[model samples]
Target: MTLSSSLLNAFAPTGTLRASINLGNPVLARRTDSAEPGGVSVDLARELASRLGVPVSFTSFERAAESVAAVTNEDADIGFFAIDPLRGAGIAFSAAYVLIEGCYLVRDASPVTRNEDVDREGNRIMVGTGSAYDLFLTREIKKAQIVRTALSEKVVDAFLRENIEVAAGVRQQLEADAARTSGLRLLDGRFMVIQQAMGMPKARGDEAAQYLREFVEDVKRSGFVADALARYGIEGASVAPATPV
Candidate 1:
């Protein structure tokens, strides 16, 4: 793909494309044995840079909020994040490239057996601070009080340590936690499906956003997303469907 000069400048004002990588979502990114960032998001960033004819540099964050901040503040040129209206204020997102489930986890002995029972009064739910599930549950869960931990990876620990009634997070993370800890299990179904997408600062203009949207659709259509997921051994997250014309 040949990028316009204006689009290239919009994405790489510093002469290199700076991508904000969030390690909070294991399905999107993770630290390899070499202690460097690697995963589907990293792959996409590199691909974008390759097309733009610029070098790619990553600014890694342990939390989604931090990664979003980097892009929103223009400290980084682009980022991957869950599509949320609150974040749309500063970031213009592409159509989602991945769909991940948001699920509830509770002690096996707990009375909550279904997704519908989790919002009842007196049930305190633990969530990662500023994560997609946290933002989602804050709006949808009217009765249950939300408890927050520093990172998504720590939600289960906080839930166990603090004795919260429910823990909310990505399905894969919660499933792994359930396996690692005894007497815990996931609810039968997901409460929500998180739409993960690429985003850049809204200041970059509508043309830039449109280009990104097209780039996302191209990658999804070309099997780049599915191939990346399989290569990374990510399960339970599907490549997002193509956007309607």
Candidate 2:
């Protein structure tokens, strides 16, 4: 797609695409051995920059909320995030490029054997503040109380420290935590599915957002997204459906 000068400027105001890299969500990003953020989101950022014919640079943040703030504050040109109504107020989203399952982890001896069992009145759930799992549970879970940690990666530790009934997060994260920490097991099935998408500041206008939407759809249909996931050896994330014509 050929972007007009205005669109190009809107998407890359600094003449380079500044992508807010959220290293918090392990499902989408991770710190490589070199300590730089890598994974599916990084691949998407590089591809977007290449298609725009601009250099790509990353502004790393430890939390998803920080990434959203960078874009809305115009500190960064774009970001990867879960598509949600609350965040959509300031950020315009592309079609989702991937789907991530959100699950709960509990003590091995806990009575909550299934995902549905964790939502009881007395149950306390720990989550990462402002995460897609946090937002979804905040809206959907009426009985369970949500206790939040500063970052998603800290949720498991917080759960253990606080002795919370359950820790809620991306399934892969919960799995890794369970594997490393004894006496914890992930509940079968998932409570939510996060739709991961690229977003720009709403101030950039609908035309720029539309272009990103088209770019995402093109990547999904062309297998670019699938290839990225495969290249990164990322599991438990499925490519989102094509945008309907």
Candidate 3:
């Protein structure tokens, strides 16, 4: 796709596109065995840069919030983020390119067998600080207490150490955590599906955002997203349908 010169300039004011890559979200990205960053988000960023005819540089962050902050502050030209109203204040989002399941984990002996059973009054849920799960649970969980940890990868450890009743995170992470640590079971179904999208600073203007939206739809329809997921051996994440702007 040939992006207009104006749109190209809007998305990459620094000449090279600096894409903020969040390594903390295993569902979106992770460091491979050789310590190279690889995942759906990485592929998308490269593809975006390719379309713009610009060189891409990656700014790696350990958490999603950090990635969002980079884009918001214009420290990075773009980032992959879970679309949320709170974050929308500074970032302009494309239609979501991926949907990842969010679920709960609890001790096998715990009485919570179903997804709905988690929001009850005495249950204390541990979530990654500033994650989509933490944001969602903060709004939806009226009765349950929320305990936040520094990283999504540490939610399981926090839960175990604090003896929290439930741990909330990406299903893929929670499933792996449940497997390595005995006696922890995932809730029957997912509580939420996080919408992962590409975003640039809102100051970049609407035209750039529109170009990004189109880029995302083309990537999904062109099979790049599915191919990327399969290439990474990722499971439980589905390509999101294009949403009209």
What lDDT would each prediction earn against the true structure? 0.94, 0.90, 0.90
Candidate 3, residues 88-180: lDDT per residue as tens digits? 999998889999999999998999999889889999999988898888889999888999998888899999999999999999999999989
Q: Candidate 3 clashing pairs?
A: none
Distance (Å) between predicted and true CA of 31, model 2? 1.4
Model 1 scores a C-alpha lDDT of 0.94
Q: Please give, for residues 1-245, the per-residue lDDT of candidate 1 as tens digits.
A: 56788998999999999999999999899998875599999999999888889999998999999999999999999999999999999999999999999999999899999999989989999999999999999999898899999999989999999999999999999999999999999998899999999999999999888888998999999999999999999999999999962
TM-scores across all candidates?
0.98, 0.96, 0.96
Worst lDDT 10-window in candidate 3: 30-39
What lDDT tens digits, residue by residue, belong to model 2 across residues 1-245? 57699988988988999999999988778887775579889888998899899998888899899999999899999999999999998999998999999989999899999887888899999998999988899999888898999999989999999989999999888888888989989888888999999999999998888888988999999999899888888899999998862
**Alpha-carbon deviation at 180 in model 1, angstroms:** 0.8
Candidate 1: stretches off by over 4 Å: none
Better of 1 and 3 by lDDT: 1
Candidate 1, 231: how far from true, in Å?
0.3
